[model samples]
Target: MHSRLVAVAATAAIALMAPTGALAQDATPMASPVGESLFAELGLPELTITVTDEGIEIDRSDIEAGRYLVTLNNESAEPEVFAGFVQIPEDRTLEDLSYADEVAAGTPIPEEGPAEEDFLWLYETYIAGGPSTVTEAARQVVVNLPAGSYGVWDEDPTSPRLAAALTVTGDPGVRVEGPEPEAAVTIIEEGEGGVGFSFRLDGEFVAGPQVVKVLNASDQPHFVEVSQYPEEITVEQVMATFMFDPSSGATPSPDMLDYERAIFAGWAGTQSPGATQWVIVDVAPGQVLVDCFIPDPLAEFTPHAFEGMLQLFEVAES
Candidate 1:
């Protein structure tokens, strides 16, 4: 993969796969007094995880299946962190999951992997909760966890090597509903050569802090990265920058786009088909870009964004 493409995907993965916290008024949101007040309104049990150069520390690891306000306080030397929890089946252990290496390396795993590599999707499908963005600033997400054994881990191998265990005890059959979302975003598959997988916004996005429900209706697992692009930048430009060609080894230039100008608002973590989660979105009145970078094995591993999974939503003043 081109360094440019890898960089962009890596950035999104870091933000979308970590233990997020509350949002502030700026593009790079931080946990603030106002944000904490907003979280209190969710009325969900708060699960706080503190990360440092040593490792990860969770205030509590045992709980029943239910929705929670997951917050990550990054106090490490690293600029960003990717930390999350995935169910480790009774028959499996952390050693049984080979995809951890790729994750720790910040590589984007392709969907529909070969027979031996099928665990990639399996792992994705089993992600119980905890999706985040790259930030030293505190951020958070609302997630519903099922009863199961889980492993909390950091995506970067060099960063603290945290893989603590978690236990969510409850009946597997019962489904607990999460808080109602102020806005809804659905991820859908477009079938073969039909613009691939894309996002379907159920309604207009209103500015300021709000809970955005993200549902994955596609066959394969998917995640979303939310950002605000300058109005002058057209959708065509974004498409071109995200375009990838495996055969020619072609990739977008690192200089093709100015990342500093792209303001990251939030991340709705990876979800398997029919899964739903809610993320905290706090943006000023502007255009917010929703996209996915997961590679499609059925399409030479091209990113879903290049296949038309990227869309701009108008955020009206609240």
Candidate 2:
């Protein structure tokens, strides 16, 4: 199974939020990026999920199973959180798979426990679309939630762990047809001498605000981290910053990745093979790097980019 916790530590810092069954009692209003962005054009139902120091807050607890414009807010003073909804196995209770206490205390989950493994399975297979990140502001993305009992938890191991429970009740319906995206991005497996991975764009990426459909076609789970860098920054320099001696067993510092300076566009969180998510990103024309930092367990938890899962492409004006 892919390790969400270690994905960014090996390359960069990325947090994937999962729910832990703690439900907020009342609804609260949070800023919705959707109101002023291209996401509003989709016209899907809206659900607000906010992560503060106290706990996970959802504007509502129950809803019909379908597509939603999920507004994720990381209001916590510290900690970058990835907010996504996940449905655990029917037999598993929220307590059994919750990461709240341990993550808050910064303690490792018991080695013999199934919580970590179970959470990973749920994330890659049972998750609906949620934003891969919400650092300190509100961002909106589209998620396809299905009928089930969901535990909403911030997936960042270092963040204050709080969970809210959500219940989706309805028939397992067909995928909610949405608007056609301006561009298509795919995570594909590239096996040459050995197994490999990479990202592919359907055509030239035009600058400015647009909708993108990210599809994971590979057998393994994957995510996309898109950033814009100065034209002077070479691919080798970015690669060097992420390079490390895995045998040393040291975590790479986030500073190394940030020192070079890149405008963070956005990311699509980890998704199971064949899963598809749509997100809105506004990017400027410049040298862009599309990379996957998700670690490959088979490669001793080495980040995917080390295996050539990165693409340096140009974003041109229309």
**Per-model TM-score on C-alpha atoms:** 0.74, 0.74
Worst 10 residues of 1 by lDDT: 16-25
Report the C-alpha lDDT of model 2 over 102-200, residue by residue, as the tens digit: 666676755433222333444344655456342211266676777778876554323345668899888755555555434434334343212677776
Question: Local error of candidate 1 at 91, Å?
Answer: 4.6
TM-score of 2: 0.74
Q: In model 2, how large is the Cα lDDT of residue 184?
A: 39
Model 2: colliding residue pairs: 17-82, 17-155, 18-153, 19-151, 19-152, 19-153, 20-151, 21-151, 22-164, 22-165
**Native-structure RMSD, model 1:** 6.2
Judged by whole-model lDDT over C-alpha atoms, candidate 2 comes out at: 0.57
Q: Going through the candidates in order, what is the number of backbone clashes in each?
A: 11, 10
lDDT of 1 by residue, 1-318 (tens): 232343232212423321112121233323332245345676788787766666666778898898887887666665445456667766667543334445567755554232323344343446644544442222676677888887666532222245667798999888877665454443343334234878877766788766677776676655676677555456766655544345676665554445545666766655656666766676679787777665555665555666677777788888
